[model samples]
Target: MELTVERGDLTTVAADAIVNAANSSLLGGGGVDGAIHAAAGPRLLAACRELRRTTLPDGLPVGDAVATPGFDLPAPWVIHTVGPNRHAGETDPGLLASCFARSLDVAADLRARTVAFPAVSAGVYGWAADDVARAAVAAVRSWDDENPAALDEVRFVLFNDVLLEAFDAALVAA
Candidate 1:
């Protein structure tokens, strides 16, 4: 598997699947979640609502992931993962790592070769960019080690230079 980091809008990044740093509700919220939902249009919300109404009546759990069709976006699929909120006392790095690993698992289930991810838990969620980067890269590397041929490329589509720098440093150090 190949790993890369690029500064760009996650919503516009071209990939077979994109990972949304979604809230537990899987409903539209701030940051990456809002952007992806907005880019994916109304169908995405409808799909999410259906998931909530049936499968996820309570809400998605932190560090867990689920997939939905990317209705109006470039990617055909959206893998939604709930990142742990630091403000809510969810400071476990393992939980943060699970977000990435589970998203990759979901992508592999969809048979997607290329996947794009945002800086999960970094924005508004209160995790530092460097911490998020390290946990993300480590999880992806560990996943790749286990599923060597499952994916072709995994791109960290960061929204800012700070995140790009953090992920790049993590990649180099890894």
Candidate 2:
């Protein structure tokens, strides 16, 4: 799979699937989660609510992922994964890495060719940007190695220059 990093709005990226850095609640909180929900319109929230009523009554766990129709967003699907909250003492790097891995797994299961991801856990969740970048790059690379041809492209759609640079450097280092 091809990997690319760019400073852009994840909500506007044209891809088969977009990953939402969602809180466990999935009802839509701040950062990328709120933005995605807003962009996708109220149907996204309804879908999440239905999921909560049916499959995920206790909310999604950190490092696990689930999908919903993208609604009004550009993508066809939205893969929601909760990243570990470092400030809450959930400091395992593996948990952070699992966000990316599980999201990709969900995307592959949907047969999505192109996926766009925000910097999961880097913003508001309190993880260091470089750490997030490294973990994300490594996870995607490892998944691609194991599941070759499952995806055509994986784009890191960062919100700012710092994240874009961090992901670009991580991609180079990987």
User: What is the C-alpha local distance difference test score of each model?
Assistant: 0.96, 0.96
Superposition TM-score, candidate 1 onto the true structure:
0.99
Q: What residue pairs are clashing in model 2?
A: none
Q: What is the TM-score (0 to 1) of candidate 2? A: 0.99
Residue pairs in candidate 1 whose N, alpha carbon or C atoms collide under 3 angstroms? none
Residue 118, candidate 2: alpha-carbon lDDT: 96
**Candidate 2 regions off by >4 Å?**
none
Q: TM-score for every candidate vs. truth?
A: 0.99, 0.99
Q: What overall lDDT, based on C-alpha atoms, would model 1 receive against the true structure?
A: 0.96
lDDT of 2 by residue, 12-119 (tens): 988999999999989999989999999999999999999999999999999999999999999999999999999899899999999999999999999999999999
How would you encode candidate 1's per-residue C-alpha lDDT over 33-127 as one tens digit per residue? 99999999999999999999999999999999999999999999999999999999999999999999999999999999999999999979999
Backbone clash numbers for all candidates listed? 0, 0
Distance from true position, residue 174, model 1, in Å?
0.4
